[model samples]
Target chain A: EDQVTQSPEALRLQEGESSSLNCSYTVSGLRGLFWYRQDPGKGPEFLFTLYSAGEEKEKERLKATLTKKESFLHITAPKPEDSATYLCAVDFQGAQKLVFGQGTRLTINP
Target chain B: GAGVSQSPSNKVTEKGKDVELRCDPISGHTALYWYRQSLGQGLEFLIYFQGNSAPDKSGLPSDRFSAERTGGSVSTLTIQRTQQEDSAVYLCASSLAGTDTQYFGPGTRLTVL
Candidate 1:
């Protein structure tokens, strides 16, 4: 069975603090890995897509790196406005739908 | 360009009732998808429509859940005989042809009483 697990269900950090969220997966025929940020009462906003190990993408203060079995979302000097639930999803070969992780709830206290 | 859009930002209905949720994918996007998010749970895939091909219904949890895409643009997800467990945020997303990056719309929060 294909499964995605995100660790540190919730994290609280002071403004300007940097941290990393983890997303691990067990699936066959890997295709792509995705990262999204979702705010309260809204749908998830697309962040990055990594298709292979050693692949990395960055946007503003966020950087995402991928491995054979997992992915990491690293936040640099996060601001309060950056606080939101980060979601990870995987799209495997022969699958039309994405498998999502439970997400990491991040709160940045000013 | 406008992104995917869903109607009735919120819906509240009694148990045993039927409800329909709608989604309008981004203009020209050839792929549309529906998903459900429950409290503290990850988003669960519900359905997928790609162009004129048959929708991928493998992820739908039960027969009570059905969806349709008309003209390959707008889609509707209907839930029959709603139960308390059906209460959750239904999200819609769209992507370009042959692409896996999906852009989502603000979800519809469904509340079953």
Candidate 2:
């Protein structure tokens, strides 16, 4: 069975503080890993997609890195607007569905 | 361009009643998906539709849940005999294909009392 687990169920950070969230997965074959930000009362917003280990992608203050067993989402100098639930998902080989991890609730206090 | 859109931002119904939620994927998008999110939980995949191919409904929780996509554009999810446990946000998303990045819409909050 494929499984995804995220660490630090909740994080609190002062504005401009930097931190990283973890997502570890166990799957037969990894096709892709995705990151998303979801606000209250809204659906998830796409963040990044990592297809292989040693790969990284960045957007503004957010950076996503991938490895064989885990993925990390690093938030640098975060602002209040960056506070949201960060979700990680994995697509297994030959599977059309994505398995998601319990998200990390990040709170950036300004 | 308009992203995926779902109708009835909120729906409140009684147990044993039926409900239908609609989704309009981005124009020209070939893939559409449905997911459910309960309070404090992760998104759960419900169904997937790719172009003209058969839908993947393996993730649907029960026989009461059914979905259909018409013209490969609009999709509808119907739940029969709603239960209190069925209350959750039903989210709709679209992508170029199953392997593409999915764009989500504001979900429809369903409340079964």
Instruction: List the RMSD of every prediction in angstroms.
Output: 1.0, 1.0
Can you write out model 1's per-residue Cα lDDT over A1-61, one digit (the tens) per residue? 8999998999999999999999999999888999999999999999999999999999999
Candidate 1 clashes: the total is 0
Fnat for the candidates in order: 0.85, 0.77
Please list the residue runs of candidate 2 whose C-alpha ends up more than 4 Å from where it truly belongs after superposition: none
Q: Give the alpha carbon lDDT tens digit for every residue of A2-62 in model 2.
A: 8999999999999999999999999988999999999999889999999999999999999
DockQ of each: 0.82, 0.82
Model 1 spans > 4 angstroms off: none
- The CAPRI class of candidate 2 is high
**Recovered share of real interface contacts in candidate 1:** 0.85
lDDT of 1 at B67: 91
